[model samples]
Target: MPTAKRPPKPPPKPYHHGNLRETLLVAADAVLAERGAQGLTLRDVAKAAGVSHAAPYHHFASLNDLLAAVAERAFGLLAQALEQAATEPDTAERMLKINDAYVACALARPAQFRLMFGPLLARKHDYPEFKVAAERAFGVVLTAACAHDPERGPELALTGWSLAHGLSNLLIDGALEGLPIPVGPGEGLARQLAVRALGVTGAAA
Candidate 1:
């Protein structure tokens, strides 16, 4: 008689329970915050999650996919922040709040800030959700700018974006502290520059 054969053991699971996709996303953000976007790797994310190297692939096809997910969430939050800022009744106050909100959000999450705007995610457009999220975030500022200056809304929005984006970069790099500007704070400087560019002499008053 032949010896009885035993069934093979079941393959290990990445996680025994709970959502693996959410776990990978959380792990990816930790790697991003620790290593920065340029140095991030899917394998490192898997390690952060205590999973196999190939585990990230189950949720994200590549590093870009992971980045897209991260950026999308960041942008969504940014949109909400700006929307809340836009609720100020006074126009000048609204502008100040908008700039404040933008910079505050960036300051609160400097790691995600870099990844969201850096060239590391050149393929971000490949992800529809990411693009939609980005547009919504930008639309908030654009709406505020347009409401402030209807005739040159598009141009005003671009100018405001240029100042805000540049200001955020400077603030992140710790390069704005010594700047010789009349404004008291980085966000104030952003509003002043934006107001000047928007031709709002009264607002600057």
Candidate 2:
């Protein structure tokens, strides 16, 4: 007449109900950092996130969708950094600030930075809202370029955008590392040279 033993309980699932989208995005970034873009996969992200295989699909319809989201977030951050840099008392200073900010943000977020400038997201060029946000961010440089020379605003804007964008990409690719230079130094030097060339002054460093 031995007593029967109680049944053992099943272990609890790992995922919480909230924040799954953010979790998936973070996992995607980690994978991107570790493996670059080629090896990224939704199932792999879901596994990294400690969620069910179907969980990531709920957040991102496809791997491209996830990459697009990552690019969007990176763009948002780039926009904020530009805006923050644009808070100078004068136009010349504002432009330099925004330029510097853009370079800094790229260095800080190289993975997202790469995907933003990379060719994958180029397929979504038809998306108006994406174009709009991109334009607004570009406008920061445009405004700055105009400040440098109103008559050459359009040309100068393109120049500034290309320079800033190029500088950031180079830094992210490690082409500019260990050169006895700082992130803001080259930008500051460029500003000084521009000011000298354009006969302008009064930008906050």
List model 1 lDDT by residue over 47-110, tens digit each: 9988878877887888888888988888889989999988876665676677777888887889
How do the residues 108-176 of candidate 2 rate in per-residue lDDT, one tens digit apiece? Answer: 777778887777557657444555666678887777777667889888677667777777777667676
Give me the displacement of residue 169 in model 1, in angstroms.
0.3
Per-residue lDDT for 176 in model 1? 64
Error of 2 at 130 (Å): 3.9
* Backbone clashes under 3 angstroms, per model: 0, 1
Clash-forming residue pairs, model 1: none
Highest lDDT among the candidates is held by which one? 1
> lDDT of all the models against the reference?
0.78, 0.73
